[model samples]
Target: MDRSEYLVHLGNLEFFHVKTGCCDADLPAQYFCITMFQIIVEGGRNMLKTIHSTVLSADVEDTGLNLAFCFTPECGDYEHEECVNQPNQEETSLDENLLMEEHWRKEESMHI
Candidate 1:
């Protein structure tokens, strides 16, 4: 089977960047997931890149990548502040907020 290419020109589309603490339209709410698989062939290796792109809903995903993020103008100061990455709460329950926060914190701290 052959794959078809499509165009989704997001011209003039803007959104808030709470992660960067800016309102710039740098990172839109566009996601492109690729489930990669590596296999060694005859004296060589290959990767199967399965793209599973999804536009984030009013909810979040657990792909371990920030390819999808929310982009809504700050309704209030509190909202914007909360939008910023916060500390992770220690608990046995599955805490997505903490995981995301920890991911960003690690990524940022490493860059620093």
Candidate 2:
């Protein structure tokens, strides 16, 4: 999979689009949803969780799905607020600048 060079945003929050492989076979991919995601930022210093599942395939088999999900301050509860006013939580306060810089750095490291 190729590295994403963009960050998705919902309102004032920032998110990363993670990809998932399609069903190998024998099942409809739509029957499943991405409930939890493990995102590594700054080379594994931070672990982020996924917020929502955006299905790209319609019950199709062997099709790729791109889910645009956000990483919030809180995890395991879907009802939690997307972002808080805390100025010290670097994981939840992923601004566009930082995300872009990270993306560029990854690209440079990969020589893409």
Candidate 3:
């Protein structure tokens, strides 16, 4: 299969500068990067589990490249904040609360 047939768009690349709190001479702080992408495949929603496992097990050899795969469903009505990449959790909570309250107000207004 051609690369374009399965691989969709590779995006939302992020880099994090991780630091070690403990003073260790041997281990140094390193930068970690994560890249997100979209893939097209056969089967419907029911086959997600098999597809996920296959993708994760694609590479059997340990090449020192740590890989994590996750399939996030499309964001629903009230999941925008949780879906987006957020650096701060406290601020996210406050913002989410405010948004929820606003949504509630709109719902109440519609009922009234």
Candidate 4:
């Protein structure tokens, strides 16, 4: 597995956005419906050392519906099969300029 980067956004909000050396993506929908998530992944040939997950809130646990079905996984190995290793995962990436722009956009969104 090679390094992979992803930008998981929900409408105007981003939930999971980061870069990982070992590619893996199969996030469950339950991770977004709430303001907190307790994820547990198992059976990994290479144990996941760093796992980062975040859930935001609009006004105190509005609803636990978890509208997070939309998912996009980024993989550098475009030619190598199993991009995200998941049947539902997709390949994607944000360039440096796009990433910089997103950084400012994310910062601004956080302030509002």
Candidate 5:
């Protein structure tokens, strides 16, 4: 993929560096490098599975990238930090969380 298109896809993935209302120019080159690694490296599926597990195990309140909140357009800003910190009305239910995980698994399979 070209740079702009790559960024758009990475942006959709809701990484902290790309989703924090930061402009594309503001992102560090390392983020792009990591993404490229994920896309191009053989056996990257294991790496991504580990990352996904780590994110799920992490304290969502402390970390900025709460998977439950990550996919929404409304989450593309610092305001998402507040949602992560506070008990928001839009918090995902247990079933919803399961659904989201299943959806992500499907998406990951498609990409692979």
Candidate 6:
């Protein structure tokens, strides 16, 4: 319903990862790759929002497996507009600076 409520619902949800085998020739015979993932759901709702997943270390000889999981929020229509506008703003600022430099160079040439 609200921001805090949504967060609380997500916080209560259980998170776990499922490992899947990855086929790679470079990996040793004893060493195999495992993929870990967890499903994130909206609080109190049965809807599936996003899937968080990552790759685990494939080195069997290594004592510890370092896992790094990256979570990317699904972009909605409204959020997509903001993402597009940011790049346009940067490009506009760069174009203005280039124009100012060009004008300054022309003035210097005239004085010379």
Tens-place lDDT per residue, model 1, 1-112, is 1111122212322122222111122433222221222222444753223222221222223433332223333423333434333465232211343355568778989999
As a whole number from 0 to 100, the lDDT of residue 90 in candidate 4 is: 49
User: What is candidate 2's CA lDDT for residue 71?
Assistant: 37
Whole-model lDDT values for every prediction: 0.30, 0.41, 0.29, 0.37, 0.33, 0.34
Relative to the true structure, candidate 4 reaches a TM of 0.20
| Tens-place lDDT digits, model 3, residues 7-112 | 1222333221111121122323211111233333456531111121101112323344322222222422232545443465322232343455568778989999
What's each prediction's TM-score?
0.18, 0.23, 0.19, 0.20, 0.24, 0.25
**Best candidate, lDDT-wise?**
2
lDDT tens string, model 5, 20-79? Answer: 121133323211112122323355552222223211322334344423222455434543
Best by TM-score: 6
| Alpha-carbon lDDT of model 1 | 0.30
- RMSD (Å) per prediction: 18.6, 13.7, 18.8, 16.3, 17.0, 20.2
Residues 25-62, candidate 4, lDDT per residue (tens digit)?
Answer: 33222222222112345675432222443332222133
- Residue 8's lDDT in candidate 3: 21
Ranking of all predicted structures according to lDDT, beginning with the best and ending with the worst: 2, 4, 6, 5, 1, 3
Q: Which parts of model 1 are misplaced by more than 4 Å?
A: 1-94
lDDT-better candidate, 2 vs 5? 2
By TM-score, the better pick of 3 and 4 is 4
| Rank by TM-score (best first) | 6, 5, 2, 4, 3, 1
Return model 3's CA RMSD, one decimal. Answer: 18.8
Q: In model 2, what are the clashing residue pairs, if there are any?
A: none
How many residue pairs of model 3 clash at the backbone?
Answer: 0
Q: If both were scored by lDDT, which would come out higher, candidate 1 or candidate 3?
A: 1
- The better candidate by TM-score, 3 or 6, is 6
* Per-residue lDDT of 15 in model 3: 20
